[model samples]
Target: MTTSSSSPTVDHAPRDPADGRWTPRLVLILIALAWPTQLLAAGGILGANAIAGVAQAFHTTQVVWFGLTLTLVSTLLTPFVIKLGDLYGKRRVMLAMTALGALGELLAALAGSFWLVLAGRAIAGFYGPFGALSFAAVRDVFPARLVKQASGVMGSSVGLVAIVSPFLAGWLIDTWGYRGVLWFLAAATAVAFALIALLVPETPRHAFGSRLDWPGGLVLGGGLTAVVYALGQGQS
Candidate 1:
């Protein structure tokens, strides 16, 4: 009797080592992280066109503050935010940050006063380290082999966003007017927030009751703020 040879079976899907299940949520989180930088950079083009409307509604200084406010607040809060993520969970912190950013953009879109817009921007500054948090999440959730490739993808996306944002912002400004920039940012932020809330899972946290260096974080935040402030002022 002749026996037929059996065909080799192939595995179709890769598994995540952390949980033994690969997830599409990692890509979703990366896309969410990309939005913040793109939104912020895109809004820069609105300066010439949007500034006039803002000045008429409020004042010229508000225009300058529009650009400065988010950077300043983000510089001050980044360290504390990272520490908070370590203690609690990066996914939780990232979701909170995304929520804050969305709220800020919504406030900016609706605000009738310059001070309110500044308030929105300050809250929006929470987005600064989202990319880093996302990278950390990848490290925590993905195997070592995938981490490097995933990180390269993330880095490349930033460069791509840098190229796209200006033209997109300019077109929005030209089409709908200045508030369009804020509206677009708000919409993007809201969508990102939703994706994070729905798909991303909380990663492992630091050991329970670990000591946190609040003082060092504070100093770093303060020094960074000062440096950013000086640079922003020098640009004027």
Candidate 2:
């Protein structure tokens, strides 16, 4: 009569492993990694197709400023973004970049002046570190054994987007005005942001307290800026 009744053990169910695996969600995340760049490339190229329209809208032949601002600002911000991603979480930085890119696209689409468009393009620079940040994210989320395959998939997606951007740009330009390209980019970025939010888990980071060499960063940034400026000038 002295024996105490033991409490029943409640068996908890294990979480689903497939949800965290690399089969589909990871693949989609990799593709989405290139979303911002793909949209930027398509919109920049569309500017050439709609040069006359752009000039008419801005009342200036300096419409090239839009593309240049988009590209250059992003380039200049890459080091900052890389360091931020390393210090914080890559996923958080990536989401911020996508959101900024979306805001930039919307601003460009509704722009009433060339300067506003330039501002929008500059805002879009947040997307500059996407590829690098995404690669780091893949490494954080996936196992070492799967990283190679994941990287290969992400790399190939860049080529695939390049191949398809021309056609996509042409179709959008033909169907809608150049402004529509900005709208399309905004929409695409929104979708990508949603995908990332829902599908991609928070990536593990080992970068806490890691020091950044400011002097080296500045030197590298200066050198890269000069080279990029030259390339942009060549295009003009």
Candidate 3:
């Protein structure tokens, strides 16, 4: 008896439409978040040169120490800021960081001494919140499927900005000077901050606590400073 057997057919899942159409608002929001982050990080491209220029302005090498101090402090502060974002809202934390950075830039522009410049650098240390918290915000708002692509675009923006920031900083230094560049950066940062405040929605995800822990901030800041300083001095 020869009998022909029929095989069961497998079913496939539905796919997303490939219409190439996207919401303008979402795209614009992503661009806003990404572009400013790129600009802020790029703000550091000629950062070493800026410190040297500050050194010359003060007629001492201590300004370089100030820059290094800020870098160390900022590195230490990063985890705390991220944690804080996880506590409060990511948008609020990010806005605060951007505002602090802008304020620091403004202070640096007007600084008259190495100590004053160092203070400004220290003030600017919270800038890490932008990229990280912005990411948190994206995760809050966007679909899981799109978040990866969005993150990729944002990361690429940083690289693209890096390619241009140093040249721009160099030109600004030639044309206006370090202080001038600081002023420009400060103004631009403030504008960006304002844009974020106006446009971005606040996102509170996995943020449960109300009380901000000071001990965490201090321990994180001090420990990070020790480790990063060790590595930095090793490089030197």
Top candidate (TM-score): 3
Those runs of model 3 whose alpha carbons end farther than 4 Å from true positions after fitting are 1-21, 210-217
User: Which of the two candidates, 2 or 3, achieves a greater TM-score against the reference?
Assistant: 3
For 123-234, candidate 3 gives per-residue lDDT tens digits of 8777744676777667765656777887888877777777778888888788777786788778878877887877776665464635567788778778878987887677
Instruction: Tell me the tens digit of each residue's lDDT in model 2 across 1-236.
Output: 59853532122212225644566655666666655545555555655666566777778977767677777777777787788776766778888988898898889888888888788878876765577677777776676677788777766666666677778777877788778777888888887788677666665444565777687777776678778878878865
Best by lDDT: 3
Question: How large is the C-alpha RMSD of every model relative to the true structure?
Answer: 9.6, 8.3, 10.3
| lDDT values for all models | 0.70, 0.70, 0.71
Predicted candidate 1, C-alpha RMSD: 9.6
Where in model 2 is the C-alpha error above 4 Å?
Answer: 1-25, 31-52, 211-216
**Model 2 residue 216 distance off true place after TM-score fit, in angstroms:** 4.3
* Pairs in steric clash, model 3: none
Pairs in steric clash, model 1:
none
TM-score ranking, best first: 3, 1, 2
- Local error of candidate 3 at 82, Å? 1.6
